[model samples]
Target: MKYIFLLLATIAGMLQLHAATVDTINVRSAQMNKDIKAVVISPENKKATSTLYLLHGYSGNYASWIKTAPHIEQLVDTYGYLVVCPDGGFNSWYWDTPKNNYLYESYITKELIPFIEQQYQVGSDRINRAITGLSMGGHGALYLAFRNQDLFAFAGSTSGGVDIRPFPDNWGMKTHLGEYHQEPKTWDAHTVIELTHLVKPKSLELFIDCGTEDFFFEVNNKLHEKLTYMNIAHHYLTMPGKHNGEYWARSIDFQMAFFAQCFQKVTLN
Candidate 1:
């Protein structure tokens, strides 16, 4: 009985040693002129040197990812990578609004990335940086990665509103791009589907997945077709689920695995 008790205690200690650590941090964004809240998760052993930025969806905050999908903490432990979850602000669509003070695009690409690099011991180059998100964040990830290839080498989207022009009145997008009928050209320039031309062949790695039942399913499919027509290489998947925490939780597993493979390839080359 004594030996068994000692063994059980040893196992518990080992598990505790390998658990992931979570921190709630505030990163200053000069573009937005305010400190943004973010959740940073680091592996217990601190072996992972790469970083992955995870963005939340509409009506969600910085804590949404971990709160909705707690398994992400375990994922960090399994994959050994630092994960940073930043608040994109409700309905910000991760864009620098022309009519509003929401400069989320600048906050993410210019401010948040530099803050993460400075605060964490992760790689500073694009090869070591990746970004992905659910819903609205999904569009933001691809938009930022496609336009700023020098900052992120890998980008993924799960059930993302890739094309905002389709739903101008929904998700407060009209506030950012103005009325679609009033400024049709501005809407076209901002939509990810229209920005497919910005993506050069083999310029960056991409992963995209959406549920057949998701409201954004049609748009995701359209974006995939556009990428294919543009001759851009990307991994796209469709599964049986809707646009909710259940689907995103499962989808994130595959995305992190894909990112791990990309990181390995970068290290090998």
Candidate 2:
């Protein structure tokens, strides 16, 4: 009898996992004049829930998150929220580049967001919205949230390249901002580390974590220190791992939980 019960329980769990709905949505970006693709994960419950904008790393597409961390489907159902994973473009750095045709920053904030709210049953308040990502997406998440605090109340980054000044030639950032030596001001304006001043004391809640051995660990530490000096409250974590899918998969669990708590508080209020 006990064995039969266990089998039925396992099947029930699998069925619940399959209940979450995943859709590929193409949002038209009027600014960039392109159809940006995104993966939207909606819970089976049709109740009005908050939205979490999840981003991908450098060179990854909208499908990256669902492909790497498939459990996010279950997490969405558990938290009773929607997850939107947007494509940041190949090495676009999620920036409104001056030299390139990529206007991701504008597209995400102005176009895609409005479309999502109009089409979905998610809440449209800052208290009901959040954003986070891995690596380049991490930097993009914080960068966007800091600049647009009215849009997202909670933000997080896992193994993010928060400081782009040090590794000027490493990523394809030069293509967006032009040569680092030639365009120092542009780099400074676009980097997340330099945007610390935009964050007020409690305006934006942040969760930042990086593997101790990750190359971006030092930058994440510097960001934490700067925020500390500014008296901005945030959560900082470091674990034994490297910058890879393994680290992101583990760290996302905590970030989603943090966002869930924030959303729950707003709901209770």
Candidate 3:
């Protein structure tokens, strides 16, 4: 009994020692003129040289990922990559809106990325960086990654609102892009489904998945079809789940594994 107790204690201590460290950081966004809060998960050994920018859904903030999927901390330890969860702002849709103070597009690509690279031990190259999110963030991830292929080598979305034109009345997106009826052109330009043209062959690696029961399933499927039509290489998946935290909690594992494989390829070459 004494020896068994000692072994169990040793195992617990080892787990505690190697656990990832989670920090709440304030990144100042010059475009939005605010100090945005983000959850930064760092590996215990500080040996990670890559970073993953994870995003949240509509009305969710920086803490959303940490709160929804606590296992992400273990993921950091398992993958040995830093994870950053930035606040996209409520209903911002991660856009540099022509209407409101939601200049998130500029903030993320310009301010957030630079700040994280300088502050963390992460590499600045596209191969060492990836971006992904859930729902609104899913759209935001693909939108930003497609536009800035120089910044991210891997991009993914889980239950993303890829085509906002279908549900303009929802999510308060009108406050950012104006009503869909009035500014059809603007809506067409921002939606991820429309931006498939921007992606060049082999320019970026893509992973997209959604639950069949999710309301965003049709849009995600359409985006997948469109990407296939364009001959853009990607990984698309459909699993048994919904569009809630439970779904994302399960989906993030696959996405992280995908990114890890991509990162390894860079290291091998």
Candidate 4:
């Protein structure tokens, strides 16, 4: 009995040791003058070559991705990369507010990326970095990457409010960008669809998808059409699902695969 117990314990210990580890880290942001919480998932292999920054949707914190899509840890292990899920604040839209002090745009691009590269053993180049998110975060991932092409090599969005100008009353956009009635131009300028012209051809690899029944499906389709019109290459898909966990959980798998392919291509080059 004693020997059997010892063998079982050894196997359990080995399984635990081989599993990916999740760490909650507080990253300080001088721009926001606050310590943001981020969930870092490190694969069993310590020598991770790349990093993926996952942002959460509105009303979500650092734990959103792991809670909704727990299989991301498995992706970290299979892809052999570090995954960083940062808190973008509830309804911050990952934007730098002009009226408020929510400078999340600067916090992410300026502070968070630098902190991650310094703290982790991941590569520190555009080709080694990727970003993606769902809903508001989906918008944010594209917004940030489109503006800062030098930082992220690939970007994706799942059911993103990509065109915020359409829904001014929802998601506290009026508070973040001023009342739509009062600031129509501001709303237009901040939208991801409006900013597609900023992307240079083949400068950034992109993936966008949304559920057919999602409220944002029409907007996503419009954004896709606009991108196609502008000749910006991207992978877009419309699947049968809603704007809930069931959709996002399955959608992330596709996005991760897309990023994995991008990472592989970069490595081969």
Measured over all alpha carbons after superposition, the RMSD of each candidate to the real structure, in angstroms, is 6.9, 5.5, 6.4, 7.9
lDDT, candidate 2, at 12: 32
What TM-scores do the predictions have?
0.92, 0.92, 0.93, 0.92
lDDT over C-alpha atoms for residue 262 of model 2: 76
1-116: candidate 4 lDDT, tens digit per residue: 23323433453234332567899999998877889999999988557889889989999999999999987787677667889999999999999995788999899999988898
Location of the lowest summed lDDT over 10 successive residues in candidate 4: 1-10
lDDT of 1 by residue, 1-269 (tens): 23323433453334443559999999888767789999999988666678999999999999999988887787787667899999999988888884688988899888888888888868998899999999999998998888888888899999999988778789888878789999999898877888888887787889999999999999999999988887899989899999899999888877877887778788889
As a whole number from 0 to 100, the lDDT of residue 180 in candidate 4 is 89
- Which scores higher on lDDT, 2 or 3? 3
Q: Which candidate model has the greater TM-score, 1 or 3? A: 3
Model 2 lDDT per residue over 97-156, tens place: 746788888888898888898899578888988999999999999999999998989999
Order the candidates by lDDT, highest first — what do you get? 4, 3, 2, 1
TM-score of candidate 4 relative to the true fold: 0.92
Tens digit of per-residue lDDT, candidate 3, span 237-261: 8998898999998888778777777
- Model 2 ranges off by over 4 Å: 1-17
lDDT of 4 at 18: 50
| Residue ranges of candidate 3 with Cα displaced over 4 Å | 1-17
lDDT of each: 0.85, 0.86, 0.87, 0.88
